[model samples]
Target: MPAGELFTVPPVRGGTKPEGSSRNKQKEYQLVRVKNTWCRVECRQEMPTTWEEDQVIVSQAKIGEQVTESGVSWVVKAPIYFCYKVIETQNLLNPSNKTLLYGHVSDPEEIDEYQKKTQKRFVVMDATVEQIYGSKVRKYFEAHNVVYKILALETTEETKSMDIVLHILEEVHKFSLDRRTEPIIAIGGGVCLDAVGLAASLYRRRTPYIRVPTTLLSYVDASVGAKNGVNFCNCKNKLGSYTPPIATFLDRSFIQTIPRRHISNGLGEILKMALMKHKGLFQILEKHGKYLLDSKFQSTNVLDCNDDAALKTTRLAIQTMLEELAPNLWEDDLDRLVDYGHVISPELEMNLLPALMHGEAVNIDMAFMTYVSHEIGLITLEERNRIVQCMQNLELPVFHRDCSFQLIKKALAERFKHSGGKLRLSLSTGLGTAEIFNNVSEETMMCAFAAWQEDLGEHST
Candidate 1:
């Protein structure tokens, strides 16, 4: 299969009749190019008059001749529109067919059964804080036919030490009897995923792994992407590789056991996504903020609320965000859609590692960025107030006073230096648009932090 031969057209579902005594109802269709397959999708409806109006058709349609209205049909002879070059395969196989694996992690027994059926090695990497749950995971694996291993690492700042991570990986590698045939499966939160993902990436030069993301943060943000890495020299995600997992098992069931603060931390990340990229998403979060808060503060679970509508809403928003952003993960077009407060968040996490959860740092970074947006006149005072209020409603830290301003300034300076004077901050002029600017001034950052501090003091006193 060659790049020149692949095409796929959109499948038109319903049809509409033509207007104004036009007896002939034109058929609509979309032609898209996959790897090496040519597919034509057609519908019984009026075809669009222009290429811009019918992208699905124009994507694969080769032009003919010029045409005009006034009861005349003409075609414009033009070159074929090539959106992307399809990869050439050795054989004419279905190269565009993606395999998806979905499973529930609600029951450890069910998870163990799935692993046994898949014939993959089940390894439970967990935080020492979650000893009981980790034990259950091990027990479930034992009950089934799957071989299991438990690497209990502490989630504290000290455990994120580079030497500790490396040692853990070494141990896992050394203990494995059959490295080539067996794949690794990790079950836990972001830290567990990161450590296990890093180890999987290194073992046998990148083996496949299945991720069972237990926490909300991992479910919505971390585990889906192929990015696998660990911290280096106390820097957050400094050492990492873009190695995607074979599959990700999202079990909202485990979220019931998470503490209130951790759950709130995850919501903080969710709120950041809503504020920066999707206006509709913001509305959804606004509607469900109370539900999430109650779910965390009380023993109530989100799954138990209103037919699980809150969880569904949150999952939908997260899925949309991932679909929009994941495709652009490797592309260097930073300004397109990476503007969810992660730029400064990483630096802050690195500087304040073991002190702040990643989502907590992101929450603070989003507030600071909003303040910068206000200072630069990119956003109005009312919008800033609304953003701050939304974060407060979610119980996320919305002020810079949560951390030392001087330390933050120093970290920003270090970030600038590390990126070779390029200000890699994800700033937004308004909702649904983000720009990565390297021209942000130190004075602008200082002013933003100062304003945030003032707001925090006012609230406290």
Candidate 2:
């Protein structure tokens, strides 16, 4: 490329030999003055340095440029770095736990300023959460003299839409927030977190939002990630952006109020991370699945008699999920193992909306993928059965009647089309290791579905 460039030799060439060494040194720099400051600036008159692979630029530092008669080519090499905090706090809404107020403020001076200021916060909460903790949340903010507006919506899978995002935007607009200083707070389940995150990402072209996950599902699965969206046109997360929160405050005590079924529902997601990356986590879920469900993730701090299995389980789930998500937040690489159950689950969940919880649909997808793994020799039948049994033990439905082979095929097709023309099927080879394969055949899918159906069809709901 350096040789083939449209050249201007007198200007571009450097380090000429003839009458050069001292002259070149003299020509290499020029004195410049700006703002009462005088300094020497190097005039580099050489070929631009660039890294190219397969005629495509992977990365370049400060960039090499090529100038043609028609235009000047320069890369605007600005890479974005976003740092968000995930704090495991206790009694977040309690007057003493100031994390809900000043935790996200990084600088001590900023925190002091934030505390001194009568803060105005815009809160988007799930209706269920508002009903349960509205008084405490209100009292906490009021205790600090924070001027706040809480918009409690019936945020469910059915209500995960852009219209709700607009509703949040309208309320946020009316509140007239300081986009830089005051961040929006989202307090609820995954759906509420997602919708509020999307709204925050949209308003002012990306304002900061804080996540307060109330359910176990949100605490482990949704609250930590950057991806946020509302379901669009019968597709799961079809309309979304990769915008993370300024901070995610995880208070496990909030999980205590959730129903027993919701606890099991959340385990489906934790199971996903385990089956993909951590065998130890899988075993923990395997051993304490029922105990967790029974206790609703109440740690020994609350239950006193039980061990701190709840803390370990949630902490492990979050760590493993972050291990996958932090590097690939924008999904620059499509071969994501975190997308294991997500492939077919999106379609299946949309198809069976209101009937199946998000994690249940994801479990069904994982169950079938496990069987597919067996069929393709990626996993043994015993391993597949064990995974399924674990699902059952966790009270997660492994089979949904609506998840037909045709639906599976269609979901894979959609995934293939969207995921750069590859299935990118994240199938587990064993308990905690997985690979993304693009070579899965339709025949194998049908066979796996048939076998999965034969094994668990009668149990389908």
Candidate 3:
């Protein structure tokens, strides 16, 4: 019988129709057809049968079995897609799904409109935000009559353990938050984002969350990705999940109070994106990077303003990041351009913390990779110099003592396993273009490091 044809069962040798056959020791068979109120099935093997004159039988293979004659079988599956938006706003408290608001979020009235819109209660998780923003968050929530609680976290590398996560989950259970609507609002740098995001994901299987990245590193890279992670067992981000937040808000106002070096720290991730994909953004950085590094935009304090060159440059960098990440948010595809410096930077960053920032470690990784690309003839000497110079010009580090060849070779071995036994290393083929490499040799890496050291004298790691 053709597929999709309906059928019924016939009576047994005892002249009794099969009743509740589902519970009996029955063979799997595809149904064929029915006549009147009775059912019939074409048997593939001899068995007890009682047939009525009105019943009809048809031939078909058993269910869940494939015929060998034609030697063909197929099943179709639909692909899953995930998508979200990233926007810039002057003052997030003014009521927006995600906003980049300027000035301190001190005024309670600014967030009044948002309280009215959301019916669900919220829990604010802070790492360093309160120290930076003070009682503004508490006062705003209180004035708006928003049901909320505050949880303070250290958000340091040492504190990124399960204990911190469980502590936050305690609050989640106590608040009885509606997983579908109310979200945990994470405010701080990448550490806070990762810890809070992990807590939110574990509750009720998955809880919606909001991200307000307070540091520049979180703004350009960490918060934008769907990845949330915490260090564990002396490993960087060993425990984590790929859960995207409902939205991320970028506000330069928060970036203003931080030290100037932090801006350079964020530049490492920005430079990674520009190098791998957007040469135009790279050029923008080459020209206006110093202006941004100086916090000129925030110093001017232009709220509800546009047409700033620095702001445009930041937006371009963000747009470039989103363009690369939106298509592969969950990283189902392992071959990603964004994985350029990230291949080794995680281990490099965690091991050298206090001495090195996340972005700075990435810059050091990219610097060596740039030389590796050069040694392989993938990029010219001039191109290699330009890349290094661009990083140095932004006050980003090009080398660290811990980024030794021995350490790198060990990390590469582990990364090779993690990348399915292939290198999957991102290399520069040209300005704004990147290619993957699977056959980089240790000797070539040594030569790359030696060349980097020779070019950068006292800066050698």
- Residue pairs whose backbone atoms clash in candidate 2: none
State every prediction's TM-score relative to the real structure: 0.67, 0.86, 0.77
Summarize candidate 1's per-residue lDDT along 1-461 as a digit string, tens digits.
34212221223255323332353223334454334444444533344434343334335453221112233232322332211111111111112211112122335665465545543354645664246466555445454444556666664444554565577667676666355445576767887787777777777777766676667777777776667667777677778777766667655556667877777788877776676577766776677677766664232344453455455555655676666556765434445344466656776776665677777888887888888888877888888888888777777776544456666676677666766666577666775455666777878877877777777544655
Across 231-344, the per-residue lDDT of candidate 3 in tens digits comes to 888788889998888777777778877688888888888888888988887887788788888753463535322546467666766778888888888777778888888766
Order of the predicted models by lDDT, top scorer first = 2, 3, 1
lDDT of each: 0.60, 0.84, 0.72
Candidate 2 accuracy as lDDT: 0.84
The 10-residue segment of model 3 with minimum total lDDT is: 97-106
Top-lDDT structure, candidate number:
2
How do the residues 1-461 of candidate 2 rate in per-residue lDDT, one tens digit apiece?
Answer: 25214222235354333322333222223333433444433446422234122333222223323343334444333367899999988788899889998888889988887767789999988999999999999999899899999999999999899999999999999999899999999999999999999999999899999999999999998999999999998888889999999999999888889988899889999999999999988999889888889888877663332357787899889999999999999999898988878988898889878888988888999999999999999898789888999999999998888898888878878887888876788989999888888888889988988888888998644
> What's the candidate order when arranged by decreasing TM-score?
2, 3, 1
Stretches of model 2 off by over 4 angstroms after superposition: 1-64, 302-307, 459-461
Q: Candidate 1: where is the Cα deviation over 4 Å? A: 1-120, 128-130, 177-181, 296-309, 350-353, 402-406, 417-421, 431-433, 458-461
lDDT of 3: 0.72
